[model samples]
Target: MTVVTKPKAQPRAFISLRSSVDFVVTSTTSEIIDRALGYLRAGFPVHFRGPAGTGKTTLALHIAAQLDRPVMLMVGDEQLTSSDLVGEQNGYRYRRVVDRYIHSVVKYEEDAVQNWVDNRLTTACREGFTLVYDEFTRSRPEANNVLLAALEERVLVLPTSNGANAYVKVHPDFRAIFTSNPQEYAGVHDAPDALSDRLVTMDLDYYDRPTEISITASNSGLDLAEVERVVDIVREFRDSGEYDQAPTLRACIMIARVSALQGIRPSLGDKRFVQICLDVLESKTAYTSKNRDRRTAQRKMLVQMIDHHMAHPLDAERV
Candidate 1:
């Protein structure tokens, strides 16, 4: 007998979209959207702070598109440097010439020169693009110090050695959107007070249950019933206080998408589907009891919850 094995799929390369983010605006988020647009239009930088998977970055991109300007997205990280935000002098080019003036005489001349490369922030400031600096707090505050002048004084100081080209006036149309998670979250830095004072800061929490259902159903291409079941289970886990990381709508979307792709019904009796949910969500929940093994306790709790929910599903209105 011959056996066949399926090949693993390769990861896709990063591609920036020219079009605006396709977002479904339910009644819950409509007001927030309008308010955010109002702040951006009134010439103030807008900042969105929220937990992971709350769609802060998505909303920022959508708002940027509303401005009818080109979009530039920059993700922050620990290694992000000031030179990365502004322009940097990269390497050098050399020109050399040799001339033979006479039979025994020769002259040689060489010149080396460096050229500046504009990074996302500088280019956005110069060309009036809507800059979305997502998760800006992940980067050290010093790396973002350049923004103080740009946001307030409408100017960006260049790192040029020559005094003549020290700064550029920020284009009148240039706008910025910043996003970050709460400080208690991992890999976050306390934003400088001066910089925070300049932005129109807004807080975002997870969408209401109904909105989450809508978002999960729309994004995952799953039936509403199945998506609801998945969402309910994840929400229960989140509220249980058993996990360090609450399973967000992002986790719901992942489970829904995989199940839809494989035609697996969301059921506790189905070992395969149960395993999928546990694998995607089990590690996120933390154990608070000192005597219990975290991994084992979490696994038992999730299994029991899945079984209970499957047998007696929550009422439609409750979730």
Candidate 2:
């Protein structure tokens, strides 16, 4: 029952989606974006659920930015607690005074008080800031209980016993968006049913090839053809059903960015380029079949894919 206080975080860390400015809105992703925005505008909390690298967190931030309110971001993890969310008495402040002047003067005074610090949730709720709770499922359900009332009743009950108001009225402008991967993923807990019921959950998968190509090209500053080649190579492995978790757009960006920066072409003949792709991608391939050696099979597949793409460079215009 002890309150644990962590240092105050910069307000911008929770709400600012600075990277969202460059987020691509292509034909494939537009519908998802529009739907999420619609739900948020309707005063409903939107939850973007998907696999890692699907850009769930990014999309959540984009939606939060669309609200045009001060932003607050809260990361969820196993050790998170209600105190962590709603704020706690950070510590105490003390002061002592001594008086000595007159011939017989002798006086002393002392004062001590708990220092109350508002957490991200409390500050955002009170100020009506848009909150993006990323990877919320990583936090235990009990830790997130504080959000039930905030989401349902628009009130936040403070957990301190320092004799202050027990609850806060949520600001009318307050809105929240949450992002998480599937429950099957490791280290993620099931969301409380009651809390889940209050949200409009949207499932996000990998972006279509063109959308991904655009994202990679824009973010990595690589030639469109090079980006497309990498994207195609990744897509082949992903769709081949060889891995439980496919490399995502993030992998494409990494490969593209490194290649562009290092002046390494995305080709099988280039040892560094091949190594970069394998390092960034090979571990994600599940390689679960008992029939073959996973490590060897995975390496071979990657090498062949790279060689194929290199020999037959994608037609940038057609792509």
Candidate 3:
């Protein structure tokens, strides 16, 4: 009997494989980090569910950074094709092989495989890159059927000369992370139960006070006192049924950013600050009429809220 040995496989070319340890995970967003870490450890895909502007995409990016894998992101669209997720056979080229008009010339031509294949999902699977399918459910589910097998069986069926082909087995380190709005929201789909079952689902809502304040102050460059005051007003307004739609952390951050950009302090006395808050509330409430009147009346009430804040800056009481 004779024994034979095969050569070791070479590593695939990755975009970049370096992990960054610095990421801010406020209490409001800590669950995102925990869920991502859990999936990374358990070898499962994670589905982050939230309303728009809830930091789903940011959370996914933070996870990719922590895992030290290069991130590949694809925003789902209605016209997305399987070839868009995988690669396609670009057309071939032709050359004149010979010139026979005078019967005195000979020439040679050659055909070869295209040197490169577009590697969206393929590269991620092969090189263990972190893939973030942002707002994946926005696209029709039919467009993503091919992913079912690739995600479950860890096999990518690529097109080749012989019809369809299979590439290197999915690397053990590969991970899939998805973010999407809830199905009830506009432009989102109820993911097939089969696919949903395979993923670890985490429903994310608005951020809590401490976390919201921390994020606003740190990211928006607002003073801590001002951040707290803004968070209080937004949280109270949402809880008090003053608006049909709840204020998202995104809205708060936006308000803070706008205030900073305008060189305005977080003082409630600034009419412009009140107007900014009103604008955010209006945009968030446009989808529902349940509290339309209440939202409309909030403008009048904001002046009082600002006056109270100014008069009793040290009240230390929640609105």
Which predicted model would earn the best TM-score? 2
Per-model TM-score versus the true fold: 0.83, 0.85, 0.80
Backbone clashes in model 2, listed as residue pairs:
14-72, 14-73, 15-71, 15-72
**Residue runs of model 2 more than 4 Å from their true location after superposition:** 1-15, 20-22, 93-111, 162-164, 268-271, 286-292, 314-319
Ranking by lDDT: 2, 1, 3
The stretch of ten residues in a row with the least summed lDDT in candidate 2 is 1-10
What does candidate 1's lDDT look like per residue over 1-319, in tens digits? 2222333443322224453332577887778879988988888999999999898988887778778887778999999999889978876656666767575877777677665677888888888888899999999999999999999999999888857657878998998999999999989999999999999999999888899999888888888887888898898888888877878889999988898899988875678879988988986855456736877877888988788778854354347
Instruction: List, residue by residue over 7-43, the lDDT tens digit for candidate 2.
Output: 4544434445565444688877778888988988888
lDDT of each: 0.84, 0.84, 0.71
Backbone clashes counted, model 1: 3
lDDT of 3 at 67: 77
Mark the 10 consecutive residues where model 1 has the least summed lDDT: 6-15
Give lDDT for model 3.
0.71
Model 1 residue runs over 4 Å out of place are 1-22, 92-113, 286-292, 312-319
